[model samples]
Target chain A: MNAATTTRRESIGQSPRALPNTSSVPPRSLPNDEQRLLARLRQSDEQAFDELVTKHHGALIRMAMGHVGDREVAEEVVQDTWMAVIESLDRFEGRSSLRTWIFGIMIHKAKDRGVREKRHTTFSDFETFDEEQEDAVDPSRFHRSGEWAGHWAFPPQPWDDQTPERLLASQQAVQAMNRAIEALPVTLKDVLILRDVEGVEAKQVCDILQITETNLYVRLHRARERVRRAVETYLEGCQRAV
Target chain B: MAHDASQSVHEEITCREVVEWTSAYLDAHVGEDRKQQIALHLAACAGCGAYVGQIASVRDLVRLLPQTVDSPSESEQVRQAVAAKLRRQ
Candidate 1:
């Protein structure tokens, strides 16, 4: 192998012998990429840090916005998070993805900022109406008094020809899904952004949101159902159009 | 729910109940008994089964989208600023 490629690999915590057989590992895990990135970040490499910031800055803002409400405050929280990330570099142990580690810091900062600004109530106030919110399954769509009572009134059809290809090619359907995400209740929106958008685990979502497991489950399920309904609605619209 | 009235207590969950419990089942948060109840409901109910599939698709599609919905240009600016600050520190 060339000297540069070997150097890059070794920089990422892989020995020269570890180079040939990466097929067993998931490409997305990219332990080598992370290790190299972490090393560069530790040394305050400007270009390396810029790449990391570009990849995750938007996500950090959205997560901070979940707690702080105001966009400006959210931006501030994200900026503060970067500072904290710099300070906490020594504590990172590769136990979790670097993304998750940085996010944990952002969540902590956002939550603290929210509390200091008395915005925590905005984050927590929705729990009371949690019961009154529409359920994942609309009761009106179910029968009320027969063998199928409480069952689906209309069968759930495939969003398209039951294929991922159709959905991927349909711009309207994609737009509908994005719109639905934006329209969700803030409580559900936050959970969806973290769990689905940020790709955080459910357990970690609970910790970040300071919600119970049950609450996290409810919010996540409701978010998924709503997004599914958007695709369903788009398909129905296309059917009517046809 | 009434249809299951004649079934054993373990199989008494309705479509609505199963819908409410679906996330619990998927997340493995419910007890084994409740898991069986949901399983029985899904086994017998085509609609509920489809609901499970559709939600999985929803998750897949969302993951396909960018992790953040903020405009790309704005994100670029934020990243540049953050990088500059990190270097200054």
Candidate 2:
């Protein structure tokens, strides 16, 4: 009945746990093939385990690398993640695809290991960013107010190679892009690898990374922009060589 | 204050806002009304239009590229190791 007690109870009612599950994201469906694999995995089928590892191992290692930023530690994380996956097979419901669920576990384990190793930078650990600051573009392009205000001052440089845009997907360019992706900061790299590289659904990525859709959007755009710059640089160098 | 991209900046969405919404738009996650706003902005804003086009191509290039960006193979040994580890569990 006291004033302080009443206020405390009201605050608790407004806490995140008290909030309704109003997330717009829908859980990804487990494909029929994935269900069969999940069943086999639960029964400890060796072939099923091997197949899953073969499919996911490389991407998982790259994902772990994003968390730990070290090859050896990342490998260890992947190994530990596989162990966890195997042990928890029986507990998996068909809610999300097996891959997303596995990533959910991997990210959690990776975060813990990264934190212990002093590399896990949660949101509070870093400064906030204006997701659309246009840092790469010149400020003089836009005027204060007019018909053209808040619009492009000039056309952006063509991202495609001058030689031939099709050649942008050539082996050399992909190799350059790969290096660029590897060099990105952890969060950016994570979003890029998962959503862009592995082609996971954005909703699934949000779940795995435990970030809001907005945060994922920013990370993905920045990550893609960074890789595009690297590719553009490579193409320009190639042009110069010719 | 206004709803048109051709009109004054009373209620125009900035280039910055478009950039912020770029990924989500590409993912088809933005609402229909906001999607229309972006389309209007792109129609009128050449700079933002080019920016959007370039970023979209980057996404296309990425999709065309291989899945694994580094150490492109998951090596037979690694798979075997994982299987063995799981077997022991």
- TM-score, one value per model: 0.73, 0.75
Query: Best candidate per lDDT, number?
Result: 1
lDDT (C-alpha, whole model) for all candidates: 0.68, 0.67
Tens digit of lDDT per residue, candidate 2, span A1-242?
A: 22222212212222222222212322235666766666677667888888888777878888787777667788878777777776555545445667777776777677778777664445433223465564534456555578757556654565434433564547787778777777777788788878987789887788777777877877888888787677667867877999
RMSD of each: 10.1, 8.6
lDDT of 1 by residue, A1-242 (tens): 22222222222333334334222233344488787777777777878777877778877886676566677788878777776666556545554567766776676677668767663346442232364476777778778888877777876874433555577677777777877876676578778878877778876676556677778878888888888888888878878999
Pairs that clash in candidate 1: none
| Pairs clashing within candidate 2 | none
lDDT of 2 at A47: 85
Q: Alpha carbon lDDT of residue A195, candidate 1?
A: 83
Where model 1 places Cα greater than 4 Å from the true spot, the runs are A1-37, A65-73, A91-97, A108-134, A160-163, B1-9, B66-68
